[model samples]
Target: MRMHRIGAAMAAFATFAVFTLATAGAALADTAVKFALDWKFEGPSAPYFVAIDKGYYKAEGLDVTVDTGPGSVAGIGRVAAGTYPLGFFDINSLVKFRDQNPDKAVKAVLMVYDRPPFAIVTVARTGIAKPKDLEGRILGAPAPDGAYAQWKAFVKENGIDAAKVTIENVGFPVREPMLANGDVDAITGFSFSSYFNLQLRGVKPEDIKVMLMADYGLVLYGNAIMVNPEFAAANPEVVARFVRATIKGMQDTVKDPDSAIDSVMKRNETADRATELARLKMAIRDNIATPWVMANGFGAVDPARLAASIDQIAVTYEFTNRPKPEDVFTAEYLPAAADRMLK
Candidate 1:
């Protein structure tokens, strides 16, 4: 009986050893990636969560952790500083950042927002019909707002007198509120975000006017996935995997924004399902799945258009060293065109 019991115990111990080795090997195989986002876990951000929940990253052997950032520009700095290996941020801001910090080797790998979401949002009560109308009006803008950062370019391109406009540097939380309460005439924000946020604050849709910067004269790309140069160089395959997983997430989000919003809602308890769904749909319509991206594939930019945008940025920004389109963006890490096509 004693001999039989010893034999059974040895077999059980051998099985446990195999299980432990397999578990350790699996953990070792998975690469941890710290991802930073330009903004909060909102509708536009649901795709990353979808990727996580769907095991897209895991399938790529990447363990990605997506964290919210303060602003688009801030996300750029986060990636550039190497605090995060990869991040999502405004491509225009990245352009400026690269120019400002020439030594830092940060570049956009995927063009997510083909059409920029920069806009001037106002209500009918404000009577701000056109860019020119912005003059002599009180415009509420957060200092760190990506839209507000383009105010100089917008004003110059639209022939609006910047000095005539009373720019109120408002907080992000109070940006829509001040406009809803008639404290400010208009606000600088993303069309999808500020527009829906105003409606949530009891503002009528018909009363709201969204002057998209793309409709105006700011020929700029909105946001993209950026990478730390050293990290990307050391782990090229990992970057490619990250991009592939992200593309999958974006495709899934486009197919069923309703289901995608569920991923975001789980992360952000304060997010209202209806508002975020509307935001996601609006982002898809106006920014993500634009005519250009639909005709071509997603995750890549038009070289000529990007060159034109760089020239436009020069109108307001005096770059010490103007970077070529290749310097600011790269298509190497992105998957094939077939893999990135959105519905």
Candidate 2:
């Protein structure tokens, strides 16, 4: 009887141990991650969709939920609020957020685009050959801040009187129509994607003039991966894995853009597949193939470039003080996948 009792006790202990281990394993596998997007899922977001379709996140032992939000500010805000772990945001906006809320503890992990995609698109026949010619012309802008301010600053910096230009606030999607119908003489657009869309719509290339923001020293980083510093600090391994998977996704998108487009279309059926595919290809070629993205590495962040961007943002936005460049991003979390591909 004594022997039987002892055996039963041992069996119970073994069962408890097994249960505890299983529960811990399950918890580790169920690490929930939420990624907030600066805008709706489209061509620029192909890599993320590719990652999800390929089970890259699952392979990394992470369960990720991708949520598209209003814009960069809202996306970053949600991440800072601890409601989400990661987000896609503009580097300029991230710097602004860091300056305004130093205690938030958010940092950029990777940059999807090396250069700014913002541009001023005008019909060539309008005779607005340069930024200077924008004087006395109606310019449609996405918002009163950021892109608009930058455009005005660019015009002013180039010796054009911003006061002479009539500014109209138009949303992004409506900007093209406004320009086409002559409601606005010129409009802010993404050079790679928006310009491509116009060309697709039978607008002759020579008839459209695109003054890319990057050409005017408005070289802010766009579509960067950001994470809450607290989460990164607490779960370094998880962060590393996430970055690894993301870089792989980016590489896959670059190598086979068509497949990437298919992946994006599968996930976001509302997007215009042809236009989005064209945009994705253009983004990969124009933005991703730059010296910064190609030489240094994919998703790499340059402190000097970042500092310059912060300065530009401060000047454009008329901020009383600008935050330090180091406050916006950390190179510590960039994955090896990007580094490997660059080599």
Candidate 3:
């Protein structure tokens, strides 16, 4: 009887030890992924922060660390260099990069800014109302700005003489201030960014004239989730999980943008909730939630539209080598269309 009792106790002890180890292993198995964001902690970046704060990333077993980036276009290099496995950037920049450096190119998985906020903002007081108005005027653009990168295309599309406009290389910090002070006749920036910043600086909303490039036939995609092909190829399942988690975060953001801004505030102590909330709402109405996104789905693009954008880009971006459609983006990592429905 004594021997039997000892044997039973040992068996129970072994089972408990095995269970504990198994649980620990599962907890430790989360894949760590580094994501390079287009800019600092801002309202538009709330969804990503929402993912991390709400445990959506953890639900996908992804330990995603979101890092602040210099600009929308620079995140491409960061991902291609393998410093970050994934990043958010303008798809137009990706197309150009794929043409320039085929071997080190990145591909987009999720389209975040479907409406493409590329725009030229000017106050009505400057007498700049149309794309043609930009000619013979002083224009400020940050060298690394996504809107500025497409200036050639904008100039060509609207039949404006590039030589007629005085181009000033304004720092990001001074792009709006220069325009606000009448130093520059116009500036290239994201539609919402320019509008809100100008408003905060005492410019009347009615005086702000925003020319969204997409409304004028740019037809380009804005920022998207891109990945280093090598990293994606090695961990296809992990990539899929990340997309799923991001979709959940985006859905939540659409439901409550203010809450999403809260997540960003936790990361950036100086972020004003009211201002960020306004920015977040504008992004959702203008860029993220759109008629196309509603009719089709989020995170996916119409192939025909993407093809035409590549051709438009070719008009101004003299590529050393032509980039193929598949090289710039792929829908392989996107969740199902049903899963992406924001409504």
Q: For every model shown, what is its TM-score relative to the native structure?
A: 0.91, 0.89, 0.92
Model 1 lDDT, full chain set: 0.91
Q: Write the per-residue lDDT of candidate 2 for residues 17-55, one digit (tens) a residue.
A: 999999999877757888887777788788888888899
Candidate 3, residue 7: CA error in Å?
7.2
Q: Each candidate's lDDT (Cα)?
A: 0.91, 0.77, 0.89
Worst lDDT 10-window in candidate 1: 334-343
The C-alpha stretches of model 3 lying farther than 4 A from their native spots are 1-24
Candidate 2 whole-model C-alpha lDDT, 0 to 1: 0.77
Question: In model 3, what lDDT does residue 36 have?
Answer: 89
- Per residue, candidate 1 scores C-alpha lDDT tens digits across 1-343 of 9999999999999999999999999877989999999888999998899999999999999989989997888778889889999999998888888888889979999999999899999999978899999988999999888898888989888999999999999999999999999999999999998998899899999999999999987779989999999999999999999999999998899889989999999999987889889999999988998888888778999999899989888876899988889999999998888877875
Q: Which candidate is the best by lDDT?
A: 1
**Regions of model 2 farther than 4 Å from truth:** 1-21, 196-206, 336-343
Highest TM-score, which number?
A: 3
Model 1 segments more than 4 A misplaced: 1-28
Worst 10 residues of 3 by lDDT: 315-324
